[model samples]
Target: MDRPAQISDSKLPPGNPWRAELRATASLAWPLILTNLTMSLIGATDVLMVGWLGAEELAASSLGFNLAMICAIFCMGLVTASAPMMASEIGRMAHSVRDLRRTFRQAMWAAFTVMIPFWIFLWNTEAVLLFMGQVPELAAKAAVYVRAYMWSILFFLFTLVARNFLSTLEKPIWSLIIGVAGVIGNAIFNYILIFGKLGFPALGLMGAGIGSVLTNMLMFGGMVLVLLFHPKFRRYQLFGRFWRPDWHRYAQLWRLGLPIAVTMGLEGGIFAGAVLLMGLIDTASVAAHAIALQIASLTFMVPMGLAQAATVRVGIGFGKRDPVWIQRAGWTSFVLGTGFMSVMALFIWMFPWQLAGLFMEGNTPQNMEVLQLAVSFLAIAALFQIFDGAQVVGAGMLRGLHDTKIPMIIAAFGYWVIGIGVGAGLAFWLDWRGLGIWIGLASGLGIVAVLMLSRWMMRERIGLLPAQSLSKR
Candidate 1:
């Protein structure tokens, strides 16, 4: 619960701005990275526990979970609006307690407002899955899981908002601590509920879903307790007017958040869509694609955390009306993120077989096919890892400037038009199969990365900087 200095980056000593920015960004980023990793572990635990039930149950839960995540990840992105907004406030005024509280409140308001309709949609998961041509039995089982897991979204989104609140204030260690606790709790709950331990009835997928709900609730509850009692955070009084109306701020949150949500959805959807394309190739491709994608995603957590840090850092610079500071902060994160991914890409390139084998091992014909395909996919994934990191971190940099509308449009064109369109044409028409899909994905990410970077470079020219910052120049 250490308190960050009540000073902005614009006030940093001039002799070594890059080093200072790097240190600041790294310190803020590592806890957030560990926090993200821990959250991922929570999901991994659920998948692993449900997997033990049987292949059918595992597949059903995966369907239900992925569907829920589409909505959940979008909502999470929406609530993320609070981070940059709050960070800017902090930069504008060292002690922006009331402003930060207002943002947090509106973020929570926005989260609840957006999640209700999604809850209704989740309740009808079976019909949706059936409509999508999933097996009827699997769809039915998925529906059961969705019914129980949907309730977790609200708490999860709330926890995310709370995490942003802490991150903006540079006190994200609690988030990591709570997330680690949640990982352990989720595993234990899944074991008990899924296995009918301690007299609990074996509810199968239903139990796994319930375990998710309970874990999210506890996570959110832990965040609440920390905010209420922690000396560093209590001063903000984030919940002081929980029942009060702040329509202006609430609307503002939506304006800023909606595009971000759509941007994130487009990125997330393309990957989900890639899975569908893999399914068309064959079950083996789907399985192999899963392994490669999982490794890519796990490695991605590093850049993702750096991206979050960039948003805060650049947002602070934006608030101070210091374009120089903004550039320094953004590029520092960009280099760190891309540099980390380059190393990851090289490792994946050098050890694709070893990494793929971590998820699947055996020399049976089916296993070997999966292993070979996974290695192939990872090879392509390795090539694009840097671009993938660049695009995400680039998006983060722009988001800090509150420039999301155009990025949303770019994501649509890149992910859907170039990414999916090219992939579909190549996989089916060109007959390159899964490898074709991977190339298309790489193309999309590279295009988006270049576009995003161009925007950042031309930010001043394009009038993205604040009026005051431009005037100051």
Candidate 2:
């Protein structure tokens, strides 16, 4: 069942694979960058708003949100399977997988199904914190916050699904627009609820949670509205026959997604564990670590966005079984991601103090102690960005190739075995403390970056590419 070329190969510009892939990927990635950045800004806004509430409130909100995000993000990674899967399917000439309705419906089912367990955990947040040995009072406060924030996951997952769906269809601008709208909505909600404006109660930490809920809801609702009314989207009839179940599609998504979930969890868990280590040292170290980690995360969104775009780009090649296209897309993304992170590393190196100052109180003696520590952490974070960007983009490239299971193993071993082992040994045994943990992070990311890159380079050498004949669509 060979299909003719949908777009003529001659349509490609004359250039080396690097220039061609760079142009293609960047075209897809720029809007995605804005979308991802907008999401991060929403989080930064929550942190900023809660900071005004009080120290205890801020601490509880941060800890509680982190706990929630750990579970939520892992599931989000699962949902991410839709990107590469849909990309490959859409690249197909066959009608069987091209409609996208099945993928959309199945993704929604998967999200809701996963949300059930998360709901139970969020509701029992206090018990979980207690079992984890958190302070009783802190656990109680966090519980209240989690209870309110839990409902937001449904909306959050919805927005993600819509974003991935549209993005794979080459409609990233829609997600970007919705995300921008979300930032505005989030700010307005926080101002009204957190400060008790418009005759609303000043709910403080819980208010922040509510603001988040409203932001996610607005994004999801906006996307849905577009899908319904927009002529382009309406053709898909996404909402038509929405109640039907497709167990096979659901299982396929889960099979592809579960390894991604564990892969993301292992990567995120390493950083969370590093934070726990910081806590053991002192309050100041923990505060400094938080500020530094936030900055790292904000910057990481760049490569993360590019990595997502890479998955789509690579997946298209994989679907067509074009090894050349796959290799080109993979390498171009790697270069661009690492190059960008390199520039960022320099920026952080020069302005570490300035960056940390934005988050700190005025430069008092006590504040200076934290400022210094954060500066040090930022320097280390700067070093990690290069490797981190490479590792993440490598992972995304592999995901596009439908190569998940081995990458998951590589990530786990790199993060837990090499990363944690080295950091724990240095911090606890040799007493380098926080700096040691930072070094550990850098080490893990570097090793994984190398391993993932080698896997990609060796794909043909190892006979990993699909052997079936491929033709254009």
Candidate 1 per-residue lDDT, tens place, 52-153, comes to: 565456557766777888888899889999998998888788767888899999999899999989999999999987787677777798899999999999
Q: What is the TM-score of each candidate against the true structure?
A: 0.94, 0.93
List runs of model 1 lying over 4 Å from the truth.
Answer: 1-5, 8-11, 361-369, 471-473
The prediction achieving the highest TM-score against the true structure is: 1
Model 1 has an lDDT value of 0.87
Error of 2 at 108 (Å): 0.7
Backbone clashes in model 1, listed as residue pairs: none
* lDDT string, candidate 2, 1-473, tens digits: 11112332333577665676676688778888889999988888887777666545655666688788877877887888888888888666424333477888888889999989989988998898778666666678888888988889888987898888776766678899999999999999999988999999988878888888989999999999998998767767777888998888889999999899889988887887776566566556666777788888888888998899888888878877888888888888888889999999989988998888877774467567777888999989999989999999999999999888999999899999989889878888999888888899899999999999999988876766777623331
- State residue 38's C-alpha deviation in candidate 2, in Å: 0.7
